[model samples]
Target: MPPCQSSQSFALDAIDSLVRCGVLITEENPEAAPVCDFWKKKGSLKWTTTDDPYHSDSDCEEQDLCSYKISQPSRCPDMLFFLCSMLAGHLRTLCWATMALDLMNTPLAEAEFVRQIHSHLWNTANQKKQYYESCSEEAAHTAVRTLIDLGVLLEERQTGGVFLGVSPLFQLSENRQKLHYFITQYLYS
Candidate 1:
């Protein structure tokens, strides 16, 4: 099977198992709504009125699941750049991510870095009412965590202090320029 198809099948099976095991309550379940919404937005799941509730067939024509495929070792930076571009589509996330990148050169403590990003997001949300109203500190934390999970950010603890920096995987000048362009186009424009 194609990689994307296999990924879709695996996701469907996992969701089915979760639902069957009562781990995920679909009906009137507030917690599951976000999970469902995310999958639906990603075109991995669909809701059908006539069929058996949720449909497994995804119509995500623009969804390129193969973007993460690294056919050559030299293409790693390209993959990371693609991932960042995807995240740039979400304004609030782009703000948090780019703010992290901006502060990468500063020798601030980890907690201070997170605090600064949260403050920046909160202030921006206040100024831009139409974009987002739920840019809470928790959201900032989640964005930072996501960057870390994606290997775009790194955290190290030493006797001097806790250091946070962009991962070496994304430290290339070309990648930095592309990321800055994304910030300008998506966040400012």
Candidate 2:
């Protein structure tokens, strides 16, 4: 599979973690079939069978389930979009991404890398520039360290601060496709 597939899986995994942790729940039916006794009649808490639309169903038992209410219907998509936006911001900050386009496999200088990233953030897409830069310089540094940890980037020996592209997945030709795939996987998977 393409490296982007992995990236997509990573994105999906992150989102799934939120869902699994109960930070977000499906809007349509938070409790399709009561999985706990909280929703049904208890010592002082009395709930009629009519309280649940699924309670009377012959094929299903809705009692003994938690009828938790979830207010946000757009949470899944909204969170996914936010996740992508944040990732795009971080990727744009990683100027070494250009090395992905260099067929010659040239390493980018650290100073040049920062300069290029600044130019991209300061000039391109004026509306988002500020928001993109909201990520602290320290955060960018941490992101770079993460890339290196993930084997996506390589540290140069000649220039201690310089970095080289070690993975082709970041190439311009594959960047968008990878990002799209990542988002799609996160939304569907």
Each prediction's Cα lDDT score?
A: 0.54, 0.43
Candidate 2: tens digits of C-alpha lDDT, residues 1-189? 456565534543544455555554533333343322222333323222232334322334333433333223453546645664656555554432333233334367655544444444444436543554524555445554655654455667573666655444444445534433433343321
All models, RMSD in angstroms? 15.9, 16.4
Task: For model 1, state the Cα shift of residue 185 in Å.
Answer: 10
TM-score of structure candidate 2: 0.37
Tens-place lDDT digits, model 1, residues 33-137? 322133344354443222255543544444222111113234253553465455543555555556556545644577877787777777676677654543666
Ten contiguous residues minimizing lDDT sum, candidate 2: 35-44
Cα lDDT of model 1 overall? Answer: 0.54
For candidate 1, the 10 contiguous residues with the lowest summed lDDT are 63-72
TM-score of each: 0.43, 0.37
Error of 1 at 19 (Å): 21
Best by lDDT: 1
